[model samples]
Every structure is written in structure tokens, then in C-alpha cells.
Target: MTTEPPETGLVVRYSFLWPREHDRGEIEGRKDRPVCLVVPVDVGQGAVVVFPITTQEPLPGRSAVAVPDTERRRLKLPGDRPCWIMLDEANSDVMPGSYHLVPLETHPLRYAYGRFSPAFMRVVLRTMGESIRARQLRMVPRER
Candidate 1:
């Protein structure tokens, strides 16, 4: 399938393969999960930047911005599932599958999935930048 540059803050579903063990660099993520596309459009190579959404809570002292349930409701996500957007390691660059946008009842869906509020996207980016500056993220060097 052909790929296009998805706008930032689109809640797209992707099968993320991330490091489960930093020391081992064991990658995981078999099932498709929701992620926010954070990369600006018309950037570099085909690799897209994204933040994976998860039900797991953030570790203490980590930069994980918990998506408010109100926002989740606005996005038409199940209210029962509390999720955290890992600002620390949630940041990733990968080739994406054909993404499906999650629809919202409160807001208009952008592309195939739903869109995140510009304000919220700003907060995410700012928090991620802070995390990077603080050196809070575990580095897994990729082969160029």
C-alpha cells in the first residue's frame, strides 16, 4: 500500500515494535495499538515519528503524559481504558503500516482516524522536548 505524510496528532493504529529490554534491545508489539503521529508533514525519509498510546502506567520520574479521560471521551475512545502516552520512550521513528484513524464523536475525524487538539499536541511536544533535555530517555542507538 502507498504511504502518505500523516499530520501530527492523528491517532493512528500501528503495530509498534519497541525495546522491551533496553539491555537486550528485544523488540516487541505483536498486536496493533493506537499511536499519535507527532512528526511534521513533508519531513525527512519515509520513517515517521510517533508516540505509542498504552494502558500501562508511567514509571515514577518518567515523562509520560496521561491522556485525560475527558480527551479520550472526546476522541471516542473507551472510557474504561485509561492510557498513558509515554513521552520518554513513546517517541519513536518507524515505517508505518497502512494506518487506520480512530473516529471520534465529539470531534471531526481527520483522515481515516481522529485528530488530537492542537493545544494538546503542543503540550506533548513540549513535554517530550523537556524529557530529551533532561536526558530521561533510554537510548537505543540505531544503525544508520
Candidate 2:
């Protein structure tokens, strides 16, 4: 049975394994960090599509995007930790509990670091689209 995501395009903390890393083996360690749940891959499969987030600034060659400080604050991210979205790396089979979803409303504590606003989602999608078009040479239709 295929399990769908509770919410598509939700940003949460998850441990992601970079598929391209051939040297890494039996890697039981999963790096838990911020990731954007792009879709469920049907928005399902007990799995979802994800874009890894990091604090490392994109260098002259890395295919990553910077998340503005303002947007990061709205996501209730840590003030001390800067964030960058990795456009080249995406995990398509992240399991449930691998990440989280912040709904429209949440408890004060949760809201401090919960599901982000639609506005931010727009920014993510836009950047992801730009990455795809320039790097992948393809077009991605907007979900809505």
C-alpha cells in the first residue's frame, strides 16, 4: 500500500542520503537537517521528494540557492544558523518521520519552528524552477 504525505511541499528536518555519493557505503548515519518536502512522489510511497537545506553558503560552483534571512526568520529558523537550499541534491524517498509539516496554525512552541507560510513556498518553488530550467534544461509547471 502506498502512503501519501500529510502535506506536500512542507519544510522539515530530515536525514537525507545523497544518491550521487558513490564512495559512501552502509552509511547508517543520516544527516538530520532542514529540507523542503517538494512532493510525495505521488505525494506518497511512504516516501516524498525533498530538497536538502544547509547553512553552507553556495560557492562559485555549487548548485545551491541562498534562503534570505527574512524568509528564514518567518520559517522560525534559528537566528544563529544561516540556510541555503541545495538545488542539485534532492532525495526522492524520504520516509515518514524523516521530516515534518507546519500547518497554517500551530501551538506557540510549534509555530516557532513549524510549517512555513505559502509565501515562502512560492519562493522555494520559484528557485527550484530556476534551477531545473538552467541546470536540467526543462520546464516545471507550477503546482497551483
Candidate 3:
């Protein structure tokens, strides 16, 4: 009997909201705007998880947090809701910092922002698949 290898690539989906805070000043100033609830993905081999942010304006100096693979796997991410995937670091050659899945209702704004597109999603998914495939191949035992 022949056995097929386990699927390495795991898809996680969840919802993310950008909170805006304004400071109470003479003219109302804002400070320390950071991204909240970032779950990083570990691709192994020094390649950290990536967070692809698809918003109207790219948050400067803000990044996602890298979480352990075990925690990420165990996380009960909601499929019906929107979510982001930590693929790799922004400096890494694989993927970017963050990718936001805009809700169907907010797709218009997403397009307006010009941060995300169908092509971009395709590339991201392809890269993720490749990473998973690579991991799976490494786990496979050789016939001696």
C-alpha cells in the first residue's frame, strides 16, 4: 500500500480592524499609531512570517508580531471572518510585511488604497503554497 504525504500548507483566515486614535490638543494631534493583533508565521530557516497590510495608507514603522508555529496552528481562526497571514518579513525575498483581506463591503476602499489587488493575492498564495511544499518535502523520509 502507498501513502500520500500530509498537506503542509495551512490556510488561516480572520478579521482585522484598524483603530484610529486622536490626541486631545490645541489642534488635535495623534501619536503612536501601531497595528494591533498581528500573528506572525514561522517559515523556518531564518525566514520569519510576513504581514501584508492592504490599507489606504501604509502604516509607517509598524509591523506584525511573529508567533510560534504551534500557537498559530492551534489558533481557532474564524473562516467566515476576515484575517491576515504572516508569510515573511518585509525585507525577506519571499513575502511582504502584511496583507489585509478587505471585506466585500469595503472592497471599494481597498481598490482605492491601491495596496492590494487580485494579482497581489495570487502571488501571495502561490508563495505560501511553495513554502508549504518545501516544508513537506523536508519532512518526508527517504527510502533506505
RMSD of each: 5.1, 7.1, 17.3
Candidate 3 has a TM-score of 0.21
Candidate 3 Cα errors over 4 Å, as ranges: 1-86, 89-115, 136-144
Model 2 spans > 4 angstroms off: 1-5, 20-23, 40-47, 94-112, 134-144
Question: Model 1 segments beyond 4 Å from truth?
Answer: 1-4, 21-28, 40-46, 94-112, 138-144
The superposed Cα distance between candidate 2 and the true structure at residue 135, in angstroms, equals: 4.8
What TM-score does candidate 1 get on C-alpha atoms? 0.70
Model 2 score (lDDT): 0.56
**How close is every model to the real structure, measured as TM-score?**
0.70, 0.63, 0.21
1-144 per-residue lDDT for model 3 (tens digits): 111111123221212221221111222112211111212256432232223333232234333223333433344322223333333222121112223322233332321111223444455556555645555211111111
lDDT score of model 3?
A: 0.27
lDDT of 2 by residue, 55-123 (tens): 878777656667778778767654467788787667665444333332223332231144556776777
Better of 1 and 3 by lDDT: 1
Better candidate number, 2 or 3, judged by TM-score: 2
Ranked candidates (TM-score, high to low): 1, 2, 3
